[model samples]
Target: MIDPSAPLPRPRSDLTEPPDVPQVLTGALRVLQGRLLLHVSPARVGYFRPQLDAGRSGLVLCGPNALQQARKLRGAEQFGGPLLVDPAVYEVRAASGDEPFPNACEDTFAFDDPLAVSLAEQRAVGVTAPMSPTGYLHAEDSEALKAAVRQVAALDDPQVVFAAPVDVGWLREEDSVRQLIACLRLVPGPKALMLGGQMDPLARHPRSVDHLRRIVAEVPGAALLRTDLAAFGALAAGAAFTAFGAGSRLRHIVAPGEKAKTSKNFSTSPHVLFPELMHFFLGKTLADRFAGAAAPVCGCAVCEGVRALDSFASNAGDRQTRAAAHNVAVLMEWLRTLTALPSGRARQQWWHERCLAAVDRYPLLNAQLLQPNGFKVPPQLKRWALAAPADEAASARADANDYRRS
Candidate 1:
């Protein structure tokens, strides 16, 4: 619960007025290794500032029910000037009539409301497009969707990235894939796409590499591919820039099955995977595969001379938040490392070895936990429930042989 008694971070209005600062906040975002975009909530904003100040490249201000929080974020002191301020206003419900979004368009929250107007007025770098919940946008009333798209397009800024449906929904059914492909083609302007590794059960294993390879090849611009650190390395071997998601994993940090899931701030715990993910992604594991000379950059703190994952993981409510920060910090570190590498071969070598160490490490930990007389499974797993088993047919969806036979 928010502390009503606590003083507000800064006094700001909820009105759609002009911003105090307007200019593509930073010049090159060159300090960031690869393009780093953060999806921030009101509560987590404080934690994110350290990374932002460290060298984070981009920002996505996501406001769900807390409209006032969004206003405060825009007016926050650290980001007062020409920073790229992307606001995602979500709350639109299904309804009749062609307003700005589809009748059922969940994407139609309030991007055009006062906050949006304020950003525009300040010329505080802004994108008109709101981040639509990935899977929910599909059933959105077409009129509303189009109107939202048009509004985004009309903005002077570049195209607002829309998350890819397949990655978020894990669209494996043949028809679903077809529909998603069509949606991508319909997206306005030079749009960026997002894909997730875990979303596709086959992505992490050997089975779906070829399909993922094709998807990467087909998508245009530098699209955002949201996956775990390990899988991100796998994809980076094939392309230049990729966007991976970090914060989602925080949800699983302290499974009741692990212990009693803590009720404090998430930033304070170590239940989810640790700093190892970042070490491998940036320092050795995946970076080794890119034989090409020009590897892309990541934006976060770990690469900015902070090698200690334990430092960030030391305090947290659940391990998930710890993992989330570690993930962001490390990705930034990895990007910085990428920028420093002179040749593709060196980067590839770094990634390969790092992955080898990481791959070797995780199983050992799992083995120790599963030992005959080890600690009992935590209650959180039982309470929240173990992830449902993967679909029997999931593996088949990525069949290389399917394409060959056809």
Candidate 2:
């Protein structure tokens, strides 16, 4: 339990997957091989843990509510992969108009409740590494927000990353951004997760993109708790690590207490990332999108000969797992390429060239498909292509580095 009067704790300085100095922060940029992570939904944890173990793909993460499975995750394999749980406590904050998040356990207590910390500690008992609970921003630099960051940083574990979802709109506020950065300095490291923000990650907004880059570029190593593919763009903007949900459902996140946008897409089916387009497409839509066009072929283990969907069909009953596996295999391959680059600058340039190539492919692919209005470049991809040319990223930050499929 937090004693409001107690002094703040010192955090462990080592924040890498196995703990290493942050090149992105210290300007000692290196190709990050050991610094890798994958975020998966609680349901897909079983599938990703083995993949991470076999490929040694680094850490895996899930939400605070995933603690209930601690019993099942006991022993050598218990609690899964060199892992960390996101204490998404911000959902407990009250918001007007929006419906409450259905899965939040923190709604039972006040955001300032010391009882909240004890509850989180109890839940974190068997996990690989404990994270202190944090909540969403009710307002910029809200005292309650500051208190929550302090509370999480004060947790017994020194490896804790100060993870929180600030409304992306507030990022445009200079003072609030400064204050937020100061608050983040209190933790072992800063890692920004944009959920329930006023702007979409790919809206191509200049100010929000620059501000988001500032927040993430501060401590690039602690990016393991992300839920969207846009987080991949941060690497181009100078982040040290990357992780996203294993499926579409897990990749996009809404703010706490805010009503999540409902999609007609099936939650159980994997949303395959079309590497050339840098967009997630449902199976049938993907097949239809490239119907007559020469579709991209994935040579990943799950999709060796034919198209990914065809490969998934032949696999039969386990389509979800197969598609999900293929998506990850494709992503890991991309990471492997980026990691093998000699230095950070080389990776950024290579990534920019890759995004530029993908953005170029959209026009030809759309033309080939005979679509009346050709597909538009995903704004994040468009922005990233222009944003990631080494020194230029800081002046106009953008982050659209989705993994490739071909």
TM for candidate 1 is: 0.49
lDDT of 1: 0.37
lDDT of 2 by residue, 1-406 (tens): 1124333322335333312234342212122223456766556676655445334354444554455444355544554444555555555553222221112453456444533553465345554444444555544535655565556566534444445555654566666655655566565544545444422433524565556565555533445345554555565445655557675535544565566554455453456767667666666566656656656787765577575442332224777666776777777767677767754467668877888898888878777778855567767677667665536654443332332321
TM-score of each: 0.49, 0.74
For candidate 2, what is the TM-score?
0.74
RMSD of each: 15.0, 8.6
CA-RMSD of model 1: 15.0
